[model samples]
Target: MNIPITNSIRHGRRYRQQGMVSTLIALIVLVVSLLAAMALMRSVDTSNTIAGSLTFRQSVLQEAERAYVDAQQKITFTQPTSDADNAPLGYYAEPQPATARSAGDVPNVLVNAVSGSIGSVTPLNSTDNSVTYVVERLCPTSGAATVTACIVPGASLLGATSSNQTSDNLTPFDNGAYAAFRLTVRVNGPKGTTAYVQTILR
Candidate 1:
């Protein structure tokens, strides 16, 4: 009778140990599932953030383009004659190096705009965003847009050898001499977005 009672107690202990092991395995599976869910959620959040940033960047770029067009229109209509710094009108006679506001560098016109002295701040009626532009003549020095000082288009076309024409005889674009101008447009849009757009025109 004593031996039978001892064997029954040992069997009971073995069953309890097996149950504990099963429970522990189940808990581990649950933890793994939870970690996977968290990782997936974080990936989704990162994707959404990237998408939003791209959209905003595109919008600001469009604004910059519109500002560029506005600057071009002003140059076409006004035909400013002075070969000097016309800060009030956002025009520079000499060429400015390609600078970026986002690169910890400041544009000359922005300083003017901030000081309330001179700058062309054109507001876009559609988006209610303000844009600034600087029109710089591509010239070595400022007095006039002469051939010796200014950059003109079709330099390669001027001296082309087509087997029939010599470099000196070839006339490019009907011997037209036009000074190239650089238009730099900066747009300040919603959500603290800034963009720079530049184009060369003749």
Candidate 2:
């Protein structure tokens, strides 16, 4: 009878110890699973934030390009009246009249407008944003000359003596001339991404 009692007591203690160990292991697993879920959620949030910033940057770049093209067209079609001498119109500058020549003396106008506008849509870490752009025009030749002289000689048809003969006053251009008039654009986004674009008109 004494041996049987001792055996039963030992069995009871062993059962309790096994139950405690199992419970402890289950609690540890539960804690680890919760931590993993939280970490995954944070990572997803970060990715989404970066994607939003990139999208906004792209939109800003498009706006800048539009502004560049509009300025170029103004320069091409319109003649520079006396009002444009001291002031010049640009991406960010005040309105200046485009340069012009006599009815037909103008060379093929190369719209060489360049821009370097840089600003953040949002603060580096903030949610709100703002942007800025800079615009400039490049001359066709090295020295300062009237817009008319820039075109190759005989390229103008307005002064031609024979009204019956229309001169194809087109002038050939080199890569160097084309490169001389380039527009540069820079966009900075939230997070640390940046975008740049360059355009030229010949």
Candidate 3:
């Protein structure tokens, strides 16, 4: 019969397919390896970006502290005038509110500190990492202790003016009036990094 010839042809084709099977498997393995390498590279890139951001934030924070101290010194020693205070000096008796985004903040100088744009605030440095600061007396405006939010110890309070050697329990306090001052600092650095810092002192 012709059956033997047909069977031999079929066996030859199967043998050819077996020979190419290894090549097909090798191609699939190569594709998978390439995908894995790409994924690993992307993960590495993301990690690097995060680390860079953290480093930049820390640097800007240090710069902010310097501006805060400067603002506090100015508050303690002298009053800032419109003439002396500007973009470079960062000192202001009044609060500047952030206009674009208020969130639920009350419309006041204190709220302005959080919601308003400081506008080219006083630059602390000449470089790109320059910082700025503002000083505000806690009161809505400067005035007398009765009219303003000043805190002062009473003269009749014990230990206000007592000497360590004095056994007098009736000793009165003599500390002068003190007012709270708030300092706000901002810094702009490389990579669009920005930071804000606030400190309060009396």
User: Once superposed on the true structure, which residue ranges of model 2 sit more than 4 Å away at CA?
Assistant: 1-5, 73-131, 136-142, 145-179, 188-195
Model 3 C-alpha lDDT per residue in residues 17-40, reported as the tens digit of each score: 987897899999999999999999
lDDT of each: 0.60, 0.40, 0.49
Model 2, span 74-180: residue lDDT tens: 44321232113211332311222333533211111212222322221223334232233233223333333233333323233233111111224321232211111
On residues 1-202, what C-alpha lDDT tens digit does candidate 1 reach at each position?
Answer: 4456787888999999999999999999999999999999999999998997787677667776776666655543122363566655667777554444553334565534544323455565767666777777665666644554456543332232112222443222232334556667666666666666666554
Q: TM-score each candidate.
A: 0.65, 0.45, 0.58
Please report, as a residue range, the 10-residue window in candidate 3 with the lowest summed lDDT.
156-165
Whichever of 2 and 3 has more lDDT, that candidate is 3
- TM match of model 3 to true structure: 0.58
Clashing residue pairs for model 2: 80-98, 80-99, 80-100, 114-183, 121-129, 121-130, 122-129
Off by over 4 Å in 1: 1-16, 76-82, 97-130, 154-177
User: Against the true structure, whose TM-score is highest?
Assistant: 1
